[model samples]
Target: MTTPPPNQNDIQNGAGSSPPRQQTVALVDDDRNILTAVSIGLQAEGFATRVYADGETALKALLENPPDLAIFDIKMPRMDGLQLLQSLRAQSALPVIILTSKDEEPDEALGLALGADDYITKPFSQRLLVARIRAILRRSELVRNPPEDAPGDEQAGTIGRGRLRLDPARHQVTWNDRSVSLTVTEFLILEALAMRPGVVKSRNQLMDAAYNDDVFVDDRTIDSHIKRLRRKFRSVDPEFAAIETLYGAGYSFADG
Candidate 1:
């Protein structure tokens, strides 16, 4: 398959550009054939690649330092993909894509919820996958260091919950003057959910915003994290349980 021309903006941005050095990709899958094929395909596209058979090994690698992008399989022998995603989100918002051989709804929904930037069903074409990788990479580069003069300077770094305050820069969350300690992922997820208040975001969308697609994650992973977030909020203010779960849909931060 013919490769699309390199993105000009991505090259100019230089946020994570490796070009001649070859971009690196972490591929985690239990299937040796799939892993080898993906690694070979990515290598053909000038990406340096690392392959892992399970989540535990992948997580260990990430702990030292994560790759620019990770393509993770949902079902693995150990430390399932969803758990790995949660672990990653608990600390860092790495760009991640969920790949699954099964096309089940639960898998899709859960992966999105866990903070996967994107999900690709199995039997996918190499070309489409490559394009998605490029697009995600370009977006990540842009987000890492947005242009100083970019429009909407006033809108940058503002986090709120109907009048509730969440100062990201200060790492503070308050409602009527009481502070809260939320995990970094929880904070970001809250920020995204609260931004539109009442507007429902699918599991996939929520995952994308919090993790920003920088890490490979699973959707069900999102459900587990949200459960943790709800528990924390319930501990502080019982009435502050406004994170509504829309069955068959996703979730919406209730309007205050």
Candidate 2:
């Protein structure tokens, strides 16, 4: 019996190798100059980009059909990047990178807290941005198109720790039979933790999981996201505050 070819989803995920040249990237910013500049840059890099002048429009487009990746400026008219990220977190696991004009740590911290996968403060190098985008795409590709497991491992679908269940195939997460909405960054962080269960994952590890490359990312960026993730768990199931933080060490997802 000849093995059948990989499924369509696998092809779409870049699993079978003819990586498409035209990938959709949604760029959101109120400034026409910034929007035009980013769209042009991405287009030059062989990506098809959609420019939105406001977060509201971007969110609507995302809900209609998710993009390969999304980059949003933090400050915008009407809905801001944070709000758009929050909404997108509920609907898709698309990679997100946030752009901001503020260099303040607090602003950076807040953007991370709001579910941005990576934060780029204004006056950033375009080359660096493109590099980061490529890195994020590579990482997401792994999750979107998982490796074929050895015969025994093929049966596994749900990765669980107590009541938390991560359904990698469906990209759905649940706690006590109820679904949990996590941003792409949050899901990747959780997946990394759950893969090891009792093992503690240092902040750097989590950072690498989200960004997929060794670049200088603020340590506080991790802390802010963790705080936000913990709050989300607390809201869903109070006992879920169990995701432990080992003062100055790192974090571990284990049975509470």
Q: What local distance difference test score does each model get?
A: 0.69, 0.72
Best by lDDT: 2
Tens digits of lDDT, candidate 2, 1-256:
2222221111122234434455777778877777656666665676766777788878888777777788888888899888888788766667888887755656666667666777787888889889888877765654455556622323656776778888665566788877776766787888888888778899899888866554456777778677777877777888676577888889988864
TM values, all candidates: 0.58, 0.71
**Residue 153 of candidate 2: its Cα lDDT?**
22
Give the Å shift of residue 64 in candidate 1.
Answer: 1.6
Clashes of each: 17, 0
> Residue 65's C-alpha lDDT in candidate 1?
65
TM-score, candidate 1, is 0.58
The C-alpha stretches of model 1 lying farther than 4 A from their native spots are 1-22, 142-256
- Residue 47 miss distance in model 2 (angstroms): 1.2
Mind giving the per-residue lDDT tens digits that candidate 1 earns over 151-188?
33136564666646766544457764666656445666
Poorest 10 consecutive residues of model 2 by lDDT? 4-13
**Where in model 2 is the C-alpha error above 4 Å?**
1-21, 90-92, 102-104, 142-179, 202-205, 212-220, 230-242
RMSD of each: 8.1, 8.9
Residue pairs with backbone atoms closer than 3 Å in model 2 (clashes): none
